[model samples]
Target: MESCGMSFIKYLLFIFNLFFAMSGLGIIIAGALVLADVSDFSHFVTSDLVGPPIVLIVMGAIIFLVASLGCYGAIRENYKMLVAFAVFLIIIFIVEFAVGITAAVYKADFQETLKKSMKKSLEQYESSSNNNIEKAAWDNVQQKVKCCGVNGKSDWSSTPMSCCYKDKMDESDQPEEFCVSGGRNYIYKEGCYKRLQMKIESNTKILIGVGIGIAFVQVVGMFLAFWLAYTIKKEDESK
Candidate 1:
């Protein structure tokens, strides 16, 4: 019965590691997509905005490698590999915890920094003929968030078309009529900075939650790996 139980645990660890490996791959892909999409706008975006995706890709790669070690160690009953996997998990857990805490501690500062960056981008919007990526990013944000400028509509010399009230604006209306004349009433009142701050806060919370959950799982996996390694050593010594 003891041997059977050990075998069951070994298989369970392998399966868990396999699943984690796949999740790591998914994260890598997501990170890659973010990096690719933002590459053209690197000069305009703050380093903070560009850093996460690169970190995600690197961390995902590390996770996949560690998970592979765990899976193979369990399958082959390699005690050294299991120990190494546990150590890797401990290191990763510490790093992730530190990152999460830092994010929480500097949340307000990050928002303020991002707001400043957005303001700079808005100031250059009309004059930035060399970089369409930055312009497109701002336009997409305004259209999707239904907000204009870093502060308010008056931040722009003329109201952006993205801020035009959809109900009142028509294809036949000239830009001067719908976008300039009496535009304050037709444009969205809220600033893009506030909306962006809310979005950043929400995403940061979710990321922190996910990091905690993953760290918990890594702790559990480390325990299981060590236990299995001990059991294998004991069984071998008995022989």
Candidate 2:
């Protein structure tokens, strides 16, 4: 009966290692997608805001490596390796919990910070003829997000070319004037900051979910690892 139970646990742990590894891959993909989405409006945010996603990606990679160690330890019935694996899982759990909390806090302050950032970017945008990172990022967000200025079309001193329908617009005739919502060249009425904010908030959900899911997986992995280690030690002592 003991041999049967031990074999069952070994198989279960091996299977769980596979599941844990896949969870890690999911986190990596989630982080990559969120990072890509953020890149479109990168100029509107400080570089430090990217830290959470990067940490997720790095943690995911570490999980993949750790999962392998767990599988090896379980299959080999190595008590020491299983203890080490449990320790690593505990460390990862703590970090993931902190990241999730950080992300939640960041979300709470996101709107105000984004609004300020957008205002700063708009102030630096100056003109349609001016080419700079702010202009470039703003233009991309306007087109991709189907949004206008910081608040709305009126936030601009004059409507930006990005707010206009490209093919229908005649820059030669009105350059940046006819985009005030009257004709075919009417600008997008929505605000870039709001649109981008929604996108960012939505993406943050993915990160949060990954963090929560990984924490659960880590806890289970730690439990199974320690239990297996104890079982293996017991069997060795009886011998």
Candidate 3:
């Protein structure tokens, strides 16, 4: 006969696994948001910034799958599967810990990179004639961020129409001379790099917080899995 304590533990483990699986979905959503946030700064930063979010998405998928196995094992009182689930939770915890640390360490380096790369990106945007897509993207970013250029209006000898404070003034309606010599009194005064750096820091903090929070939960899960597995093993040996 199963002891009352063991029965209680079994139900508790099942419920915990259910919660873990749901949290996995939350992590995935958090990762997606971080990835989207990185894209907003894509014009200034390299592809390396996407790494943490990608890792989080993959880890969350893994957790969701493992939690299913854990739930099944807990319900069936399967010792082997319970042990496997415990191992997976430990592996996930280690991965999250490593990723969180790496992201924290690289935050300053990435901000420096963003600052250094801005001028080069602006130069590329300016020199390319087939940059309609780039132009539109930049205009959207500029309007949303309310920033003039990499540094200021002075950063552009030919600033885009979006830089001008006039609401939806037609670019073609401008004086030919104004178009040719693109400095305008209405140009947005703030720099984009500074504003974007603040964005990066805020989004990265959210990512790291999610990873750490999930990792701590996994630690609790690992303990329960191990305890339940050991209890089942002891019970079997005595039979």
Candidate 4:
């Protein structure tokens, strides 16, 4: 009964490791697909597109190989093999953590740059155009617009500034939030610019989230590998 239980546990661990490794592999493949510059593959590394971190791709490959080795070690009940695989996982985790930190720093810098660029653009638009109609449109947007870090809440509101916006809009139907009541006799030119900036800010947040998640997964994978190896080694020594 004891032997059967141990066998079952080993099988379970193997499957768990395999599943994580497989998931990592899939991430790698998807990342690669995005990285490819073939005619069929839209250049995935564009500033607009969210591409997986290159460090993640490397770490994922390492995790996948370690998981494959762990499966083999479980089948053979070889403590030495398992220990080797676990050590590799630990190294990969450290590297991944370092990469995640670097990514986070880069994101901060990028966001700072984005805000500065947006401010400069707004200033230029204000300087170049002086028409009252155009000025009114910009004035409306300025009143309603919340910049990347200007307001704490109720930011990024996409309310329409004028009725002219409805006719010139790409889509016939606009969301309630984007649609202003009645007919807007005048439209703000800067409104769309501010909206575009808001989208860029939101996307930066999403990329930051992805980097954090990858870092967490690497930490978890490292811990599990080490714990499993220690337990398996102790069990073998007892026998």
lDDT, each prediction? 0.75, 0.81, 0.80, 0.52
72 Cα displacement, candidate 4 (Å):
1.7
C-alpha RMSD for every candidate: 5.2, 5.0, 5.4, 9.7
Q: TM-scores, in order shown?
A: 0.79, 0.88, 0.86, 0.51
Best by lDDT: 2
Count backbone clashes in candidate 4. Answer: 3
lDDT of 2 by residue, 1-239 (tens): 35987898898999999999888898889888888878888777767557667887899899999999999999999999999999999988887777667766776587788788888788888744565777788778888888899888888886767887644443355444345343445567668878887887788777767777788888889989999999999999999
Clash tally, candidates in order: 0, 0, 0, 3
Candidate 3 Cα misplacement greater than 4 A, ranges: 166-185
> How well is each residue in 109-144 modelled by candidate 1, as lDDT tens digits?
877777778878877776666667667877778777
Q: Which residue pairs in candidate 4 collide? A: 137-188, 162-184, 163-184
Q: Model 4, stretches more than 4 Å misplaced?
A: 1-5, 29-52, 111-167, 170-220
Model 1 stretches with alpha carbons more than 4 Å out = 29-44, 126-137, 168-185
TM-score of 3: 0.86
- Return the lDDT, model 2, position 194: 80
The full ranking of all candidates by lDDT, starting with the best, is: 2, 3, 1, 4
Instruction: Order the numbered candidates by TM-score, best leading.
Output: 2, 3, 1, 4
How far out, in Å, is residue 101 in model 4? 2.0
Better of 2 and 4 by TM-score: 2
